[model samples]
Target: MVQPAPYLLGRFLDPIFAIGVGTLSYIQYERNTHREPGHTLYDLLQKKFFATKEQTQEKK
Candidate 1:
C-alpha cells in the first residue's frame, strides 16, 4: 500500500517560530544594553520598596 504525503506545511512552522523568537531576543538585548545602568530591576525594586517618607509623600 502507498503511504500518503507527509504534511509539508507543518515543516515551515519551526523556522518561522525561530525567526520570531530571535527577533524578540535581539530587541530585548538591545533595550537592555542601551538602557541606563540605574534602570535595572534591583534599582527599581529598591526605589519602590525602600522609598523614604518624603519621596513617598511627593507622589501625592
Candidate 2:
C-alpha cells in the first residue's frame, strides 16, 4: 500500500530530529562530565558507544 506524503515525510524527519537532539544532548553531557581536555565530538561519541561503565566512571 502507498503511504501518504505527510506520513512518509514524518517518518524521515523523526530520526533526523531525534539524532540531532541526541547529539546535542551528548555534547552537553560531555561538557558537564570529566572528559579529557581537547576531545572532539567524534571522540566523545566514540567513547559513548565503546567505553564501558568502569571506564567512564574512572574519568570522574
Candidate 3:
C-alpha cells in the first residue's frame, strides 16, 4: 500500500539518521571536551554497554 512505503522508509532511515547524528555529535564532543581515559567512541560504547543503571546514575 501507499502508506506502507512511507512507514518502511522511516523504519529503514531512522537508524541511519541516528548514526549520522551521533557521529557528528561525537566528533564535536571530542574536539571540545577534555581527553579522558575512555574518550573514544569505542571506549564510550564499552562503558555504556557494561555499566549498570545505578553506576551510570552515580556518574551523572
Candidate 4:
C-alpha cells in the first residue's frame, strides 16, 4: 500500500507550483495597471513580432 515516488513528489510540489503561478499573476496585474493607457505587454510583443512594413519604416 505504498505510493510511487513520482506521485508523492507531485503531491508535494503542486502547492509550490500554484503559489509560484499566483505570484507571477499578481506581478503581471501590477505591471498592467501602471502601463500606458493604450498599450499592454501583449500588444508590445505582438507589434515586435508582427510589425508591418510601414510600422518598421516609421521606427527608422
Q: Candidate 2 on 1-60: residue-level lDDT in tens? A: 998556534877978988999999988898888678758687767798989999989999
Q: Quote model 1's TM-score.
A: 0.41
> Model 4, 1-60: lDDT tens per residue?
998556534886978888888978965995967977547656776798988999999999
How does model 4 fare in lDDT? 0.78
Model 1 CA RMSD to the hidden true structure, in angstroms:
9.7
Instruction: Tell me the tens digit of each residue's lDDT in model 3 across 1-60.
Output: 355434534887988988898999987888688667677776778786988888889988
As for TM-score, the candidate ahead, 1 or 4, is 4
Clash list (residue pairs), candidate 2: none
Question: RMSD of each candidate?
Answer: 9.7, 7.5, 6.3, 6.8
Misplaced by over 4 Å in model 1 are 1-9, 35-60
* Residue 1 lDDT, candidate 1, scale 0-100: 100
